[model samples]
Target: MNASTAWRVPSPAEIPGLSYDALVEHLRLSKVNVGHYQSVVSALQEELAKRSPTNAYRCTKCGHTEYQVGAIRTARSGWSSFFGVETAQYHAIICAHCKYTEFYQGKVPPGQQALDFLFGS
Candidate 1:
């Protein structure tokens, strides 16, 4: 087979019912390099570093001030959704001894402002 035959692009006519959003979602889920996902992530990291919110929690033993950002996991045990499925619930924790800080997971609810800025929404 020739190079063109080996690397043929799929046409919408061949792929019956693929909507633009669906195709975009497929590309995103497949981790395709359609856009600068890394750049977005980097910008997010920078924003997180700059505007990390801290919760004050005193250690029961040492009594040190701890700065922490909430944490979250992308996947979980069992949850259902119309499109795909619910991933996981976000959570937060604090350091007991040294009162170290943690990375920001996503958002803190009623705080879409940060997301709007990050995504330009």
Candidate 2:
């Protein structure tokens, strides 16, 4: 294939759909230049890093390394609930040792947010 039609490095969103063996096979079959190959490798590495479950999350309160991610919670105040306004969403990170909990604002995808608003998640 010509340079213009050559396969490009996949984005972060696309990385999850691609298996390592499939990526290797694609690289082998494609006429990817050295720069493109390097870019693909770098992108794969980044994706792997992002997917790694070995993240070290230390609790600030008790300095515990083990933690759990709680489910996404939707919060609405009395007025907001009454008015049917948008609800604030959050995820709680709980420490295993001291039961320390930290809440972080959750980022719901636009499509999921719309569906949640419609179906009440």
Candidate 3:
């Protein structure tokens, strides 16, 4: 993607008199939704924590815990946008013992989250 298509922080020269409100307005217009991005990251983290092989899944039916693999859709259903891009999906393992399913939507990468958390809105 080009610079404009990707996330960027404008240089001071780009907007010498930029105020907080102005900056926020620019972000909104540019489709830079920070909360949305954070939500996706949080979802992925929760999924990762549960899907770790060492994590045990308790079967609702048998009360047994086991390890298994699973998949989750990242796309938000019934959601539309002017941009045609859809969210990515990530699949992992759940518990085999209980037939439990762990689904992770909004598959934001851990590296991306680390960058965002350390550097941005």
Clashes of each: 0, 0, 6
Residue-by-residue lDDT tens digits, candidate 1, 1-121: 2455332333434333443333333334435543534334343333334433443355554667654545653433333222223344454556646755443344233244334334542
lDDT tens readout by residue for model 3, 49-76: 5544446556555666765665543333
Displacement of residue 99 (Cα, Å) in model 2 is 1.2
| TM-score ranking of the models | 2, 3, 1
Give the local distance difference test score of model 2: 0.62
> Model 1 clash tally?
0
Predicted structure with the largest TM-score when compared to the true one? 2
Error of 1 at 9 (Å): 57
The whole-model lDDT of each prediction reads 0.41, 0.62, 0.47
Where model 1 places Cα greater than 4 Å from the true spot, the runs are 1-56, 78-86, 96-121
Work out the TM-score per prediction. 0.25, 0.46, 0.29
Query: lDDT value for candidate 3?
Result: 0.47
Could you give candidate 2's per-residue lDDT for residues 1-121 as a string of tens digits? 3365346566556766776544554456434466656546666666556543335688889898998888554545775455444467677888999988888664455676566667665
